[model samples]
Target: KEIKDIVPFSLLTLHNEKYNKLQQSGMSQGKMKALLHNQAIGHLLKKIAPNVPEAILIDQFAKEEVYYSYLNKESVVQTENVYFSTKAEGIHLAVAAASILARYAFIKHFDNLSKAAGFKITKGAGAKVDEAAARLIHEKGLECLPAFVKLHFANTEKAKRLVASKYRK
Candidate 1:
């Protein structure tokens, strides 16, 4: 059976507050990614109890131990069934399809966030992202950023400085 047919579509996100909290707790970025992946897998397993698929192929995002710990704690499914590879997305058709779906969902969410923020929110840690973040602060109060960006990123501080400098102008 096609993975898309057997596994229902699930989109999981870590809100900014949760993301910052985890980061503050000393969780590495890879562990955070594993946390989200575990959530999605757990959700699917609970939704289809007793009919768990034979195997799960995941593109490697974190250490295998990180995923195993999360899955063991949060999922009812067997950990032995899960396999991780550095480039599983390119090797496995199912992983590739899932990657495409995830990218599509991210783009859609980013678009909505841009609309709400009144400008295109840049991705990554580029200088342009700092400019966009500063714009976000200028247009909306700093409080609004929690909904649009990961608060723990250095860009937050950089943006604040930018906004303050603008006031001095």
Candidate 2:
């Protein structure tokens, strides 16, 4: 890859304070997702901003709605070189390349996570993932949850309730 740098950080991990803030902020689900994406992309831009890359590009999530609000409501810096569009993947080589790199890093991170956990830590918030997480909580105990799970997720609550009942009576 000819990219200047590819920085990868896990958002929903024990070390990141953003997860706790997100839980307390009570933002709508859509806004919460946007905040997470914004932070991920923002971190990359901030890191490489020192090098002053040729251009920053992205795949637009929605119309005037999300972007406009994000721009106005937040301190998203944009100069002459930034652009956003629906299918930037199709139109802009940089956007497509970044997307691919991000996906590769994401999968690789989880693969290592699964290895460390001694089980296949499934992706996405479905029953299987819930089951795996609940099992981890049961076997490893609640303290270990922060190490591998996004504690703010509703599924965590459900898992906790299930665990409480299982050990109750």
Candidate 3:
């Protein structure tokens, strides 16, 4: 619900546009940009309140990174590097809030995808997940896969094979 409220349709449109541009240009360079964005958001959230504990902020950052990595295979290296440093400062409320928000968003997105696919898809965005997703696509039809899932993931190919084998048997 929070994610649904904060991320408007316009943002989705913008993301789609950027994604298409990246695909067409063969750029695929947003990994760092995404990390920086997460870091900045986390920092900003941590700064919102002086009373918020540094431990909380650090936990939030770590959780957010873990969530993203699990869902997108995107390494949150910056978050890991700053986790201990920010926790020691005890003044990073904004970062903490941002981390929580990031995690919330990831879960919300995964839920949405699962809903679209008409099945409770697990959160691990690894090869096993891809294989499972491919089977879902084959069984339910391609239209079932959510738009947010990166089609370029190698798991997609594995999934395709899984689907083929299912039909063969």
Per-model CA lDDT versus the true structure? 0.78, 0.66, 0.52
lDDT of 1 by residue, 33-143 (tens): 776777777777778778868798879976677666654555434466788899898888878878877887788778888898877888779789999999998888888
RMSD of each: 3.2, 4.7, 9.1
- In terms of lDDT, the poorest run of 10 residues in model 3 is 7-16
The alpha-carbon deviation from the true structure for residue 31 of candidate 3, after best TM-score superposition, in angstroms, is 5.7
> Of the candidates numbered 1 and 3, which has the greater lDDT value?
1
Runs off by more than 4 Å, candidate 1: 1-7, 46-51, 70-76
Residue-by-residue lDDT tens digits, candidate 3, 26-93:
64434434444455545644554454333322333334544355336543433433443435334565
> Model 2 — TM-score against the truth?
0.64
Q: Ten-residue segment with the worst summed lDDT in candidate 1?
A: 69-78
lDDT of 3: 0.52
Candidate 1, residue 151: the lDDT equals 83
lDDT of 2 by residue, 28-142 (tens): 5456555555666667666655666676565777553665474567765553565668788999776777677767667777887788678898988877787777777887888
TM-score of candidate 1 to 2 decimals:
0.82
Query: Who wins the TM-score comparison?
Result: 1
Clash pairs, model 3 backbone: 42-95, 44-94, 45-93, 45-94, 45-95, 46-92, 46-93, 46-94, 46-95, 47-94
